[model samples]
Target: MKQDVDSAKAVMRELFAPTPLQHNLFLSDKYGARIFLKREDLSPVRSYKIRGAFNFFRKALAADDPAERFVCASAGNHAQGFAFVCRHFKKPGVVFMPVTTPPQKIDKTKAFGGDFIDVRLHGDIFDECYAAAKAHSKETGALMVPPFDHPDIIEGQATVAAEILDQLPGDANPDLFIIPVGGGGLSAGMTGYLGGRIGNESFVFCEPEGAPSLKESLTAGKRIKLDQVDNFVDGAAVAEIGSRNFDALKSFAADQVMLIAENAVCVTISELLNVEGVVLEPAGALAIAALEEMDRQSIAGKTVIVIVSGGNFDFERLPDVKERAMRHSGLKKYFILRMAQRPGALRDFLNMLGPEDDIARFEYLKKSARNFGSVLIGIETKRPENFDALTGAFDDAGLRYEDITDNEVLASLII
Candidate 1:
């Protein structure tokens, strides 16, 4: 495996140099540990994905019967990487993305492939798009470039670990490696490469809380497809771990996988952007976000490596990202209140709020009766505990309100 990865690394150099492995002072100081970030986001296509795509394409082209065309399905990073590889090899390719894929990703994929690729908008979700891509590959005899399931893809991704081991300062091994898992390609490849060099206990895998396919599969002793998935963390929101990828990961215990909330990931994204001026997509933020969830005592004096997976963020989503971060930090909340329709009612409610409390949203549901109305209110505050005092004041004033901030269904419907 190491030899294969070394060969893959050699192939990778033909395109782009290895991504940097740098110590992160802010994170190191915050955790009281030596923290290093494998900046895969710095790759030519802004992700580690390019490595796999390049390897897959290189091997395919060298085969006795080279494919005339390539087809792939992806909503974001993978598609871009595939497109970039196709353009580099001057091969015709087709990329199928979900109909609901963000325009920024679609545009970037098209831009990467230039005239070498065709972008097709397929189903509303990835599984549907993947099926369509597969059908097209079968119909046209084009080679299918899967995101993370193939052996060549796995071998290509292992190059990341090779680079890490080669680039670690002073050649000192890290006590822990926090890796983010989506389809399990990168984690599987890294673990496979580190088989002889690093112990299994040294690895920690992270996945979005809304999608725990790897954890579930490990628990079931087999691959388990999730019935539903939250797409907020789009890069890592896989419904099922790839079969081959799962085979590489199934040996790990289920408890080894940590699930991070979507909102928590948003908080990390906002922090990295605001404090470090480092832009990361949600999946890219996973490893860093896992640091907050780890036991400080266990990691305080350890050397840790976190993989920063990708940086293909769309700036247009910044407002929504900030909103999720504030909500996760308990600095913002939504409420449903029954208020008198008469004049000065809102003023009275405002007066009850603490000095630091500010109304971020206020809307009457337009279901007003003769004397009362239903109101949707969102509040932001400097501290979370201020809400206790404000709510106490509301109670004392005989106001009727429901704290719907944590109510998923209610928030989805109205907030």
Candidate 2:
């Protein structure tokens, strides 16, 4: 960090204004502690990824031939980031993305790059797309801008930490700094900058439960590659911690990193939007959700800073986010009920529901049975407790039902 971070910070002044580090009154009051959010969600690319991408462009052009084109592989945030950087530098860019990537992201990437980039949608996953980008770079002699794995990228991300140190209201420091981890670029950069300045224990790294690459890698004392990753939290759903990022973060104990459930993150997103009017992508909610897992009394009066990583939310996914939030809150449920084939069977089932319960979906999945029919039902309620009452009523009525709310197989089929 010896003047390197400061230099990065100075260079970034040529970029967009530093993203705000604002005190959140709602979160602070609830946590009974001072809470600040590094609003990287407000960045030009709506994510901190742009810092790394831009820095890669900055240093690469200075050190190598400025005429060398830039190439990168990403399906979402990084793609937009690289696209923006290519335009900023007026350099020709070649981006490779997964064919399965949503059109919303593809359009955004195209919009950001405009005349500066050529986008290729190839492969189905990131690794395959990355390989294709590399091949393109090799064939075209373009300089590849890695998303998170290089020294310049890490240095670029470290600028966020430098800004935080400067932006804090006073000559004060946060007792805890919570950061969301994916490829670990931001975590490594921030931790690297802060550890020597503040201390290692002050940092908390959060990763998605479905893709705990950083935590798993730290626990195993090596880079651990996950075979399968739930890409629901796409912004932070990396299957492996970046090698260079891991090197920067490996000094900390495994417990320093926390795994956040994907659904719990959705709950945080919904709460932030409904209560604070803050819209966040799933990864952006990770640091805030991690608060729920912390020892309340331990953090009661401490000052904390959470990096709200990105707000590049696609409104198209609002339904899915709301669904996950409802499931996490226990206010919505799905069940398969065994109903008698008699005339009043449907009426009796409806009668068992509480006044606050409303059936959202009801269909007979199996009607071939003579005595009973397999009915799939989705219910929503005003409060989570209403479900308890409804279940008790069903039990008393001798109704047989299988709660499929948490059943992944059933949820995939019906929810």
Candidate 3:
């Protein structure tokens, strides 16, 4: 395993130099601890996925049939990485992506592979695309390069850990390492390598709350598929944990894994973007979000390394990201209010709002009653606590209302 990791590191250098390991002052001051960010986002493909893709292609090309073709299913960073490797090796490859994949990613993949790859828009969901890729590989005798399950892929991904240990100062072995989990390639690789190197270092695994595949698999003591997964965090929203990756990580303590809410993660993404000028995808913000859930005292003076997984964020989703961040931060809220139908009723409700409150949205839901009407209102405030004051004013004015800010079902349908 050590030799494989070392070889991966050496091979990676041939493609691109090592990713930077710079100390993060913003995070260090915020957490009152030394924080170093492993900028895997700065990789050639702007993600760490290229390492596994290159390694898979390298090994397959050296096999008995060096001329064999390659195929894979992905919609985001993986597709770009596979396309990059295909062009680098001058091998014919096919990539299957969901029909709903963004145009930006499709174009980027095409640009990377140039004439070396064919892109196929298969089904509406990833499962459909994956199935198509497998069928094509089996029928054409081409190699199927899995996104995160194979031994070579794991070994290649482990090279990130090797680089971190080699790059850090001799006295700076991180006491805590925070890793983000998707299909578990990065997390499994880092944990496997670091577990062997340092006998006592701690590792915290972060996954999107909407797609808790690793948490579910760990609880069940085996790999399990979720019936439904929210794909808002597209990069890390995997429905099932990889079987091979699970085998490597299942032995870790269940409590070591931390699941973060998708909306909460959006807040971190926005903060990093605005404050540090760092653009991170949803999965990229996982390790940073995990820091908020840790015991501050335990890591107060300790050295910590947080892996910034990828920077494949699409600017088109900026509005949705901001919306989620506002909701998570409690600065924005949606409510259904029943108000008196008199001409002064609207004025009365407006007066009830605190000085810090602002009305972002207002619409009439129903006006059936002669003396009463229902209104859908969206409010934004300078601080979350302002909502409490506004609600108290509502109580004093006898305004009937229901706060649906955290009601997923109602908010999904009405908001």
All candidates' lDDT scores? 0.93, 0.90, 0.89
Best by lDDT: 1
lDDT of 2 by residue, 1-415 (tens): 7488888788888889999999998988888889899999999999999998988888888884574688999998899999999999899999999999989999999999999989998898888999999998889899888888898899899989999988998855689999999998998888888776778889899989999998889889999999999998888999988999999989988999899989999999999999989999999999999998898897898889999999989989899999998999899999899999999889988888888999989999997999999999999999999998999999999999999999888799777
Candidates' RMSD to native: 1.2, 1.2, 1.2
lDDT of 2: 0.90
Against the true structure, candidate 2 reaches a TM-score of 0.98
RMSD of candidate 2 to the truth, in angstroms, is 1.2
* Residue lDDT tens for model 1, 122-213: 99978799899999999999999989999999999999999998998785668999999999999999999998788888999999999999
All candidates: TM-score: 0.98, 0.98, 0.97
User: Which of candidates 2 and 3 is the stronger one according to lDDT?
Assistant: 2
Q: Order of candidates by lDDT, top first?
A: 1, 2, 3
User: Residue 124's C-alpha lDDT in candidate 1?
Assistant: 93
Worst 10 residues of 3 by lDDT: 194-203
Tens-place lDDT per residue, model 3, 1-415, is: 8888888789878789999998999999999899999998999898999999998888887878674698999999999999999999888999999999989999999999999989999999888999999999989988898999988898888889999988898878688888998899988888888886665338888888998899899888989899899888788899998989999999877777898999988999999999999999898888898888788898898899999989989999999899889999999999899988888888888888888889988988886789888899999998999998988988888889999989999888877
